[model samples]
Target: MKKVKHLFLLFALLFSSLLAPVGALTDNSTGASSATSTSQSSVAAIKKRGKIVIGTAADYPPYEFSVKENGVSKRVGIDIDLGKQLAKDLGVKAEFKVMNFDSLLVALETHKVDVVIAAMSPTPERAKSVDFSQVYYGDNQDIVINKADQAKYKTLKDFDGRVIGAQNGSEQYDLAKQQMKGAKLKRLDRVNNLIIALQSHKVDGVVMDSTRAKAFVANNDQLKAINPHFKTSGQQGTAVAVAKDSPGLVAATNQTIAKFKKNNTFDRVYIPRAGKYMSQRARQNTVWNYFVLGVGNTLLITIFAVFFGFLLGLLFALLRWSKNLLFHSIAVAYIEFIRGTPMMVQVMFVYFGIGELIQDIPAVVAGIIAISINSGAYVAEIIRSGVQAVNHGQTEAARSLGMSKQETMRYIIMPQALRNIWPALGNEFITLLKDSSIVSVIGVAELMYQTQLIQSATYKGALPLFIAMVIYFILTFTLTRLLNYGKRKLNRS
Candidate 1:
């Protein structure tokens, strides 16, 4: 119990040190300098910085979507054009940060992006969290259905008792709930996924922006779009969202939007430009080109996570083995907490929650940190079980030889414990490799994210998914063989 208490104390100290920098950086990032700058208005900051970071979910087309330019993926659409124009009006450049649709408002509130221009509606609920510019682009909501079933779902009333799909956190989703009452709603993060669901008959129809619906219908022969004409309180138009209290920035964006409106930029310029990019599809040979990039990032994240996770696991294992009660409790608590929660939530919390404080932390870095922390908890328990499997006599024998606890652990116990836990640790590494896909939600450009990009770019869902599956299989299969080889060598030695 005394040893356990000591271990807990040590773990606490180490954990505190690990977190100290985060707290320090948070303070520094929002310190007096930041306070003083607050007086200068958001517009002044953008002018001084020379760029406005625009957050957007780029999977929705015509409004915003991904297209490859010279073998590199680029976000292009009406919204992108408007963002560029807005930045130009502000005398700065536009820099876009792509993420999930649901995360856009949070990104704005956390100051991760200066503005959100992702075909977003200035709904009353959203206005409470972030300020919105005047309505910039307006369109009727439409329901997209399989061409075969187009006549089956003509109006809103027809969708009642049927399954309807919409992107989560979208105005369409809300409309389905309020107007198409009795319908089973399937909420997905990406519009591409919703379209896939519609095509597969998983959902009877998908509610989406009229322009986006038309774009999808034009690309896919099996799909057709129809207007359900949802009853809305007022004009439901897209707007630029900014952090609350940034009246100067909102006004500036409103001015740019007014110019856009007066000149009919949406119809004359933005739509045609987006359509031109959309018409250009990748050559057949280059369809799987993004897999290489995905593999590189996947390997990078898995390798670094395994290295750091192992160290943390070892530390926590020692803490769990300590006789001190506090140490045992701390280790136990951490292991259970991590094991109980899902990795997806952990990845998001680290990216959005912790990243909120360390505003400059990259999404990839946040993903690695979250994965490492989660892996550490499980690894710690595995190590503890391995150490317990060793005979108690080994410890007594070492102590009788006048060896200190530290030396005994380092030279004697850890070696056997490692051998016993090697397979389990290898399994953990494999699990992490597959689990790394969760970081795609934060736009880490990993395997899954790249696959989504390919899906949006090519408008072919199943093929891109199949390619990603095969690549993942190849990676895991090779890793399994290497792990087996190492195990055999360990047994021989």
Candidate 2:
């Protein structure tokens, strides 16, 4: 009887210990529940990570834009300062990630960035995908037009039959669609591009925040701002966007913004600072100064992508040529899938999609990997065609001479295949060199991205574009000459 009682006591003690934690967790008196919840919060995660990534499109001046200080490009504006403040409040470092504005929400959703501070409005549609903090800044809308046409477009009705421009996926874009019923809307990915369209007469006027319009007019004598007096349902102020379900992060951001409101930090300090950066001399903006950085990165991406692409292509070609059914099917499926999808989507997938798993992957590395995978699919077909074009009797002759299949391919078939595929391979290289521009969407700092930077700095869009065109032509033309020289040498051999 005593042994039975002792066993019961031991089991009871074990059960109570397990239940003790559950009771403590359920009991609010001990505060253990609150402590656990706080530890699991998004704010806690950010604090643990030591840095908060801020996503921004650095093309809108007075809001967010790039500036060169001592030959180093820096992002500075109202939004950037606000981002820094938010990070400080969170007790973490601020790391800015520059990408297209249209990509911001996607980046937030994919965890590529922790917050978006690019002067983004907290619209209902966007709120469905991500939570937003309280609005930090608000202003009325205005239309920027040629100074010569200022007298012609006084009201919104004047632009009814005219073409109007706005940044794609922006509040101004929706407002243009809603208010300018009779106007043709030109949606661009960047505010700089919209300004360029306005300057080139492609867009008669651009709808943007009054602050930005005023800044543009102040910088360019040829441009002027006019209020079109578009109706608004409510104040369309910009806010910080965080991923959905991140209530703790949203609360933290709102707290930081409340402090900014109390201190008037944005109005008193950030604007004037941005203006000072913008006032730098235009003479310092020569396109030649940035050519080396631009060209070097472009060539680097092209060369690495080409080298890896060729190797992958040869492997896939062999797999497809293999008599094994499984190998051939995999090769066919890979080739078709990659060839069917757009290169831009692939680039984004590698950066944002694959990047979700492999945190801290460099944008340039992601761009190279995506481009190589894409190029490999096309290169595989080229290699397979070249191999096929070689006379089969040569393979038979080698084998009949006691050469193994591997030796036959390496010695007898590959030499002839190389001679035939040289021109096609050269063409592929040039194509890749040009297509590398697509990686600029993910902020690779290639030639096209550098040209955009120059455009933003000088505020002379057409000239920068023309300069980039000449540079691209020189690169491609020089490459063609070298290819021809190589072809001639191969023929002589």
Candidate 3:
């Protein structure tokens, strides 16, 4: 009976090994076939996914910005409305992905978004990177100036040698370079930022899309747009951008854009819906209120990241100390790789790169994970050094007293190693807190992100930046004092 059981177990192991590759190959074959099928038609791929993702920078009003309806803030604008229409035409739901305007093209190229429907001009430079649909709207270029200087400017040559501004990567930038000869150009990332620059006299004027300029000037009494605009090199017609691989998607989008234009949807439906949000008047949230919310989120992310990072560091330290070559190599590789790269790149990779595989990872969660993983690598080195600092005699003494290696590690070595490393750990915590600011790029809504939003909304660039700096000082100063107090308490006990 025993011999028969042994033979049966051997057969079972052999059978399982033989089936594993066949199962894996079948899955690979299915995945390859589906990929090929999807590649044939981008329209079919979007419909199969059940939603078409549209990327837009939501800070530009009347083109793409936030509005409150039914007490819920919804993204509304001409471009947003057209995005919904395009998705409907393709028979899929529209899902809007809000991101930095400068990152929109990268988002599309990386498959983070399916198409870009922001008020983006189909410039020749942009066309080289991605395919553009037929024109949906034609907005002219206008120079925005301080209302006080409105009459001081007549034509592009009148502003020669004066300071000018434009949104970075915008046609306005190109226009400013060509028309505003010998002038200093300040290129900002958002239209609102350009308005702030103009209002504060940081820039004498800004060349921007006429529609966007109108929205800003109407909202602020201090600014006005040039009546006779600068002569730009070409038309400023807005269009949709898709990844170059998606020819079918681009064709479908062009068809929808043509239909919308032919039916006068821009006049009948798009204009009416979008115009309501243009001149909204409401009580604005104070800068302090925004700062308070930002501080709370910053602290929450720091605490979660530091705690998990410490735990991971402990695990990594054990792996580094292990006798096995594979474990030590893995620990060393992770530490080197993470420490060698910038946190911003890591944050983007985890959010967009890993997110490409694992669908729907929240930005906040991804940010925290990136921070934790990064801090863990540094902490691991700190711990490994702390352990080595302990005398070898200590381990020998504990083992000679009938303590097993596990017990010796837990009670004898770990306690001493931690005491030696406590100050280093605290310092790591402080560093992690400061480094958390980098996650703002991925829209974590932390202190820096909130401050930028406040600057854009209130048009008080200098004040918001100074206030953010002071707030950060207060946070780091308080944390440093608390850590010192903890260290003193540890010394007493």
Candidate 4:
């Protein structure tokens, strides 16, 4: 269903703010190492360890949602049950780690989690990362349109120019983008949020897994999927996965699936869980529009935020180091305030507060402005610290050589400061990548926007969201590595 999306510009901006990177290294290394010590060690390791840790983004539904009915402790849904059963089959207790939806794969790759049973699919691209058991569920993307607009929206071609949404870094997202060549694709990270966007009129339509669409639309009388025969594109077959080298977990998982299928338990679980949302066709793929417009919005916002943030940081740095006590005080106040207060609130103030001074301005403009201001305050403190780290005698020496104050600052103080600032600035760039997920509020359809779209589409809790997280980690991890590399380069220079 269609939503204006621009109104949510503020909401998206606020929502996309973020989690710090996987913060610490737990001592699972020995366990992970033992699992990898030999090809035959997986089952043995789990037996000796007495537990298998599963990682999932817990907010997903049906498949992996959290429930606390009847005043009991929280328990996961189908996925958790399935994991527990499989662990029992393997003679171990199943432990799950609830985390960001987008961070799962790297966690798996790094051996932070034992097996990824969070409704994982067998995408050709994803196969490179790990091995999978038999098809747990056949997944299909469903195309949804405003119930109000369904009459005029005869077919997929009619969707051209309409704003569509999906979760970023998701197979559905890529599929939506590829299929809807002419329409505008709004990509986000949280699948549930995308449904919210649809309800809010942020998108004209959205394409997602049939299961999630049923859950969300059944709740919202305003939306409806196109006819049962609606064309679909992305056909991602889902299954449970183990780390690439874990043949034991792989074999154990396959054996479980074999037992499940032989006894009809697979159908009993998969059908009621995911099949209830099946579209018209007996078996078909998910096809939806993509984000043809927002890619530019994403790049532009990042570039502008960096440019403007850098300039403002320089100004604040000058203020921070000013000889005048008043300016210095103002600078300190600015630094402490921005640092102390949350960036999301600051974004709200800029985009929703004084933003009224310029109504109907581009959403991207508001986004860049918000991030630039937020980043400037942070970079200011970084630059101030950098400049202070330089030797005081550098300035004195230049002045003693008869250079003017401005020239001395330019030739002597600034270079060292620049060097010092690079690392912090580099870190900001990576932060900027994660933070840009915030810009979605201004309707800048980026990665997180796409993720939300997928979440809304996939009724399965946490799995879709977790899938989005894995994609985000892939994105941010590369970003961190690049930033770290640059920091190294700057330090060397």
Best by TM-score: 1
Model 4 poorest 10 in a row by lDDT: 279-288
Quickly count the clashes in candidate 2: 0
Expressed as tens digits, the lDDT of each residue in 179-297 for candidate 4 is 77888999865565666677677888777666556654665677887633334433455678677777777888888877877878755775465333322111222212222233445
lDDT string for model 3 (1-493, tens) is 5423432333233223323555664664355534642463388878888899888887777788765444444678899999999889999899998777877887776567889988898888888778888888888888889999977897887776788888787777887887676788888777777777777788888887787777777777888888556664444678899877577898899899889889998878886666666554123445666677678879977987888789778888899989999899878877887899988887887676555444455666667777887898999999998989999999999999999999999998888888788899988998888888887777677898777767755667788989988888888899889988877876775
TM-score of the candidate numbered 2? 0.89
Off by over 4 Å in 3: 1-41, 68-72, 151-161, 177-181, 227-235, 267-275, 281-300, 322-326, 391-393, 402-406, 462-493
Ranking by lDDT: 2, 1, 3, 4
Model 2: lDDT equals 0.83
RMSD of 2: 12.4
The better-scoring model by lDDT among 1 and 4 is 1
**Global fold similarity of model 3 (TM-score):** 0.80
By TM-score, how accurate is candidate 4?
A: 0.50
Global Cα lDDT for candidate 1: 0.82
lDDT of 1 by residue, 54-101 (tens): 999998888998877787767899999999998889999998989999
Model 4 misplacement above 4 A: 1-41, 70-75, 217-221, 227-236, 266-493
TM-score of each: 0.90, 0.89, 0.80, 0.50
Cα lDDT computed for each candidate against the true fold: 0.82, 0.83, 0.77, 0.64
